[model samples]
Each structure stands twice: as structure tokens, then as C-alpha cells.
Target: MTSTPHHQPILDSPYVLDLFAGPGGLDVAAHVLDVPSLGIEWDRSACLTRYAAGLDTLHADVSAIRREAFESLPPEINVLAGGPPCQTYSVAGSGVGRKALDEVKGYIERLMAGDSDEKIDKELQKLSDPRTALVLEPLRYAIQATRSPNRGHRPYDVIVLEQVPAVQALWAHYALVLKNIGLPDGTKYQVKVGVLDTETYGVPQTRSRAVLIARRVGLGEPFLPEPTHQAYEAKGWNRGNGEAAALTHQPSLDEEITPEPVTRRGKSGGPLPWVSMRMALPGRRKPFLVRSNYGSSGHPGRRGVRTDQQPAATVTGRISRFVVFEHLDENVVYEGPRFSMNEAGMLQSFPPAYPWSGTAQAQQVGNAVPPLFGAHLLSAALGLPVPDPEALREPWVPATEEERAKLRSQGCGAADDCTARCPRPEDQAPPRSVSQKKKLSAG
Candidate 1:
């Protein structure tokens, strides 16, 4: 928690409600930006996890929270956002009964609301319809139940949802719901969904998340953000392309490799320079990927630290640092690079001082929503003013070799330590010790 101008505990600033707010990542981003947020999580332990972050949260099943209650919030909400539990819809978790989704596949399949009307109302109607429209997938119905801004309910100026790309059909559902409700304050809105890399936003991890930015009429037309850094493109450097070496520090493929396709600043036309791994995580070049063999197959950190110059993958719950980059041989000595929970939090966009409670796996991964991705969408919706890119991405440096040596001296990386690895999210230990080594580093 941070102090305000008067030194009071600063809980949140952007003012959002994290419905199904698993460990409050969405809320964390809004709060880091000084946006006040109110998060709700159905899982009792999950709610306590948000409380640990100093956030005000309601621990209730989202389904049970009447839409009328959410509508009662202040009408001028800056943003209404959440990453509803996506596991049920995710291919990884959907069971055979998820066939309920197949019945409504057409609604999900309909990508375009036809551009005939404004995207907002269409989104609303799509959600409110009983036909099980997949436009918003499973979550749309919940969103529509809330009163519209016009109805004196908790009217939102913007809405943001984070999830995997498989939920694109859900995006269409939201558009239709907004259309059904018509634009609030006569402020029309446009919705856009894109794949965002945390590294681009300055986090060392290469986590990719689906981002949706909805801009209200007065704010200005929706726009994609521009990239602030460049990853080294090896092909250009080797081909004698002017300034290829200067473009990025990431080692290129054969000195002539092309970089990941990206819009400059998350743009549509040009690719933005990628943030480098060493530049991103600073000292994590050789750490072992540790885990407890439970969540995420046991990657030991949030936004698991990226190396080999690749983009960091999305940080997820049920991940354990004890699992990453481990040798397969049962008898091999376990000396190698590994990430501390603090390192994982840095990659996930949490402030260094951000207190994560609960078990190690639950606390770190649960509280973060990649700040880079959060800023990416907000900037687009508000026609973002110029930002100090450095300020937004407080870069993270790994612990020095000496620090790692000490962790190794302890029980870490030993085959014996690996034997007792806990599988439950709440039963894990800190990478070596739980003390985080840094303060907040990303926007």
C-alpha cells in the first residue's frame, strides 16, 4: 500500500469493481495507476487475497450479486472491469457439458455486429437476449444484468475485460449489449480487442493477454497505443539494414531475424520495438523455472520471467516457480537459475511494495494484472496523453549472482527440496525466502 498526498493509506485510485476478481489483477493495475478500485471475488480465499493488497473487496459469488447492487454505484464510473473466471470457457477446463456452448456457437461466431448501429447498444442487446448468444460468451449475461448508466445505475464511461482470444465471441456479445442500451450520455463507443505482450509494456515476462478498450464519444475515437521500445532484429543487423543493431538489444536470429509482428505502441501499421529480456528482467538470464507440480505445471513465478530473448508468456494462477527450467533427469544436481516470487510479481506488473497475502502461489499470481496491458487499453480509450514510457514500465533487474548463490546454499534447487514440492496453490513456499527484493517497477 502507498501513502497519499496527506500520507493516508492509498488503497486504489482508478475506481473499478473487479467482479470475479481473482486475486485482483485488474484492480491492481487500476490502483497502481492511482485509480481507486473495488474488487469482488466469489472464492473466499481469493477475496482475502485482495484485502491483503489493501483493496476494498466483496467476497461473494458474482452470480449472487444482484445487478441492481452494481448499478447502485456512482454513476460516473471511469471504468467497469473484470476478468471473470475464464476457466470454464477456456479449452483447458471446459468439460463435456460445456457443450452448452456449442448450442450458442452462432452468436459467438458472429464477429461483426454489422456496423449498422453504434457498438455499445448492440453489445447490451446481445447480452440481454435469452437465446444464449455467445457474443459475450458466458459473461455477457452478467454484464447486462447491471443497470445501464442511463437508468441511474452504475453507468460506466468505459468497460474493460481481459481474457484469452478464444473469448472473441464474447467480445461480440458485449458490443451487442452496448448497442441494445444505446450510448450512455450520448457518448458512443467503439470496442477493440488485441493480443498484448507484457514485455512491450516493459515487464520482463512475455505474457500475452487479450485486451479490450472501449472509448466513449466525448473521449475521442478509439485508437491503438504506440510502442515505446524496439527489440533487436538480427536479420536487419546482419543484412546491413541501417541501425538494426541500434533498433533493439535482443539477439536476432542469425543477425537477420525479423521481430515479432507488433504495432508501434500496440498499433495497427508498424511493429514496435520489443523490450529485451535482460532489459526486462535484468538479471534472470540463467534462473531455473521452479514449480510445485500443481498449477501451470509449476512455473515458479508470476508472469514467469522470460529468457532466451523470447516474449514472456501470460502469468497465471496455480503456477509454481519450482517447476520452470528444471532438468528432467531424476538424479541430476539441481543448480541453475530460478526466479523468486518477487521476480514473478515484477513481471506481472505489481508495485514492489504491493503486499500479496495467502500462499505463495495464490498471493503473487493472484494479485496482478499486467500493468502494461492495463495501460495499453486505458491509453487507447482516453486518447492517452504523452507518457514517460520509463515511468510506466519500471524495469526489473534480477538479483545478483551472489544473492542467488546464497539461495542455492540454502535448500533451494536440491533434489531433496524438490521432493516435498506442494501441489496445492496455498501450500507452496517462497523461492528460497519470501522476502521480495525490489519495489514497484512497472506502470
Candidate 2:
């Protein structure tokens, strides 16, 4: 009998290129639901994501990706995903070090070819392979940051681009860069920059992002993704015609989010539901009386403080080492002013049993992406079923009895709550899996 070539699955999940992958939070989320992903990360925690998932991984910077690598790959890599190191615009590390998105601005400028080939090669290394990058940014930062000495000194791309409300201003800089490089005002790539909340999309935190959608296909103004969940509305925008009542009456930001989708002569979907802090990563008990320090509140001149009763602010690649908890002696535990690495990562949403590898001397858990948050974003993009809130109640694996007590006292509903915080069942997970029987290879 003659051997035949194997046919590929048409419905096979699209391959993804994770850029500036950090600790692969985005890849982990997509992988949890079975989305095929290839990640490029300069950091070790992100490399561990591939090892944990039985997938291929490359250690490199995103901007440094080698385009020649793609010539040999399959054509199905439908998506290029990433949240490039937002340190330049991040609210947490906003110190004297290139505050207010300066570094990201520089990165983007380099991305547009204004920088030296060597510099671009260095930054591009953040990606294991080469592909166009999609950036997420706020309107103000978008415009102000992209300003260069060569700018003709005018906001561009406002013509064909549909301004995603709230952060339309943020698009000023991004739009300008494309225009300055002589790219036309037409479909440079589907760009949508707006202030979106996770709660409105059915996640808990009141996180708002200046999301931008880019498609290499040159489709003019990528349609604003139809929102599946509804929570808040702008002060005056009316309900979209034909929006479902179930989606409109959300208890979220009350009237702060966009109302039900009402169509003008044109429109397809409504805003996503805002999953309140209570809904997404909800606690068994109510959070303390506080809004959110989610933005740039941690800046020195800015006054912001976190309390034990509240879900933590967004967890980043570094700070995963600090543990957070409430003291039965009330808030006494916090008085010590430190947390176990395991405790901090859990609050940010890593799974309870996922193993991490690195020396204690190395920042293992600190270099991670909150898997839960990453998963939710993937669900929205792939149109996969959302994670059932109740089903997410996995018991965390704990390191010690004291850690167990810490979770129990905090009203943990599952045994794994402790482990979810640390992810290391034994010591830590490494970039390479211990199970030698298996191997991860690239297509």
C-alpha cells in the first residue's frame, strides 16, 4: 500500500505569534482553551509556558523576530498576539524612569523604521520570529508619545479611522506614525483604540484598555468587535437598537458603560459586558470600600493605596513575588510588609497546579502573566465559551500549613487556592519539563 500525505484540519485552531510575550499569560490563556500558539519571549517565565503546555517555545525579544523563519511555517498562523512590555506606559513602575510611555513611544518609533537597523534588531529579538506588531495604548499617550522631531506637527489618520470613543485621542500618535511614514489614511490595518472595561465584558476588574485591532489584510477600519457583555455606558449615548435586554441591564458601572447597542444606519455588535470585580475574580466575601488604583495612582505624587479587602490591582511580570493576605488578627499580616511569591501570583490568577521552574534565587513566579485574565481575553477573541465562574473554583496547591491557613482564613472555597497563588507544587517549574518521555517541537 502506498503511504498518503496527511491533510490538515480546516477547523484546526489558528496559530498565534505571541510578541513581547513576557511570561506568556496571553499564550497560557489561549492554550488553556486549546488555541494553537507559538510564543517569543525574552523572559524565562514565558518560556516555561511552552514547557508546561507541551508546545514549542523560543527565547527572544519580540521586535527582533526573524521574518525568514515564517517562510517555512504553515500558512494558518492567523493571529499575531501580544501586549508588548507596557513598562513605558505602565502605572505601577511609573517612576523617573521614562515615565508616561516614553519608552513605548521610542519602541514604536523604532518599529516604524525611524531607528537604526541594529536597534530594531535588538528590540525585535523580543519576539522569537518576525511579524507585524499590534500595540495597545491610551489616546493621550498614543498622540503625545509618537511626536518626533520629524512630525509635520499635525494629528493624522483621523479621516478614515473610526475613533474608538474615550481614547480616540490616544490614537493621535499611532495614527500619526503611520501617516508620517507615508502610509495612507486608508486601511493601514484595522485599528480600534478605545477605553474598554473587563467588567462590561463579564470579567470582574474595572480594567479599561486602549485596545487597537490591526489586520495585515488591509481591511479598512476593523469593525469594532461586537461586545457580548454590557455593564456601563457613556453619559449620553442611547441604547443601541435591537440590543438584548439581558445584556443591557447589567449592574456594572451603572450608567458609566455604553448602553445596549443601538444601530444608526450602520453597526453590528454592542460593547462587551463589564464583569464586575465581584464577578470576574470575585472573592467569597465582599471587597473593601475602594474603587481602583488600576491606573497610574502609584506614582510618587499620586496618592493611591491597596487594602487587603480588595482584589489586587493588575499583576505584572515582575511583582509576582509579593504575597498579599488579610490577617485574622485583622490586617496584622500586612504589617510585616512582604508576601510569599505563591500568594501574590494566585490573586493575579495563575492555576493552582501549574508547575514553575527556576531557582529560588531566580524570580520564577514574578515573571508571569495572570492566566485567568489572559484566558478571558482569548475567550472574547476566539469566540470560545466563557469560563464558568463557579467552575473556576479549583483548590490551590499549598506549600506549607501556614500558607494553607492563610487561604482558609481568607475564605477560600477550594483546596487549590493556596497552590494557585504559587503554581509551584514542588520548589518551582523550569523552562524545560522534567518528563523526559515527551518533547516539544515546532511545525
Q: Compared to the true structure, candidate 2 yields what TM-score?
A: 0.49
Which candidate should be chosen as best, given lDDT against the real structure? Answer: 1
Expressed as tens digits, the lDDT of each residue in 1-443 for candidate 1 is 01111212111234465565666666655544556666655444454445555555655445334333445444445566766444335545434224434434433333222232234335535432222232232233223423355444433556677765555555555555444444322334566666554565555454545666665444434444544445332233323332223234334323433223322355654445565433445444332223233322122332222233543444555433434442223323244655455556655655444445455553446445766566655545444442333443443333344543432233123312221211233322223211343332321
Candidate 2: C-alpha RMSD to true structure equals 16.8
lDDT of 2 by residue, 69-164 (tens): 323223445554555433223233425222333444566655555344456546645642122122332222123223422333222222211111
Q: TM-score for each prediction?
A: 0.57, 0.49
Predicted structure 1: lDDT: 0.45
